[model samples]
Target: MSNPNTPKEDDKVNALIEKCTPILKKMTFSSFMGYCGGLTAQKVGRGMAIVIGLAFFGLQGLAYNGLISVDWKKVQDSAVSAIDTNNDGTIDADDLKTYWSKLKTIMSNNLPDASGFSLGFFYGLTH
Candidate 1:
């Protein structure tokens, strides 16, 4: 039997819900987007970090075992080429502008709430 003086779990939950209900009701669309986008970014970021970490370790293990060979020079050259827009042999402001434009295009094409998400994404990354 439960203690008569103890608070029930359902009562605690109900109280918590009551406390949050007004704040939730007061949320606006932009604020809602910001909250959801930030939450999504945090979750996705953690997931991506884990996946990338596993891939990096897996690739290293394969290379160490002679099952795969990574051409470091090719990889470096491709990475440079990707960011060195205008082929100036240097990554500068113009390359960054190009990268931003490409990112914007991708965001618009893929996301229905790109602007709000972008704002929240930056906020999320910083916080």
Candidate 2:
């Protein structure tokens, strides 16, 4: 047997549906995909930040406890050697300029969503 209150409940449901119909119609597939992509990027960025932060802190703790020793001079020498592309035994302004140019070219060619990913990465790091 149908309840006596069914008509009133049906009226309320119909009114709610009518109110939501416009909002549903405005949501397109592209909008949905864009939102999903952005959300995925943000989540991935956050995860990367967490892993990097943890690794940094872990290394710091280990270094502080003297569990591992780092030869800073050796490290600096290695870095200088790596950056000294001209092999002139020195990292001069010209070397830095060349390095910067190469880095810019590589980044521009490789990273398509660089701006968005960097923004999301910084946001994740800060927040």
Candidate 3:
């Protein structure tokens, strides 16, 4: 007994979902990589505000995300994880210093470009 205005979880829909469950459950290489990438994006987005504030304070070195490795947790803390300027629970372009800054951060971390192999990559604190 359900109201016409309300939706019901019918067997057909459930059956369809069950049919696709196996495929979704199997994590392929692409899917696993995608999941990891998504997690990394979330981590970076959570620290967008801190990054912006750091930039304002002349800590531009934090902005450089070359191929070199750095403590992401410390970097994220600089932005203050709780500050959700975008109200999206993550520091994204909405609250970042600028759109270009956001792009730079993401690209520098995920894609090192041709310069990644160079020794200068280690020196780029703000790419």
Compared to the true structure, candidate 2 yields what TM-score? 0.42
The per-model lDDT (C-alpha) reads 0.72, 0.65, 0.53
Global lDDT for candidate 1?
0.72
Candidate number with greatest lDDT: 1
In terms of TM-score, the best-performing candidate is 1
Score residue 72 of candidate 2 by CA lDDT: 59
Q: How many clashing pairs per prediction, in order?
A: 0, 0, 4
TM-score of each: 0.48, 0.42, 0.26
* Error of model 2, residue 41, in angstroms: 1.1
Worst 10 residues of 1 by lDDT: 103-112
TM-score of 1: 0.48
Predicted candidate 2, C-alpha RMSD: 10.0
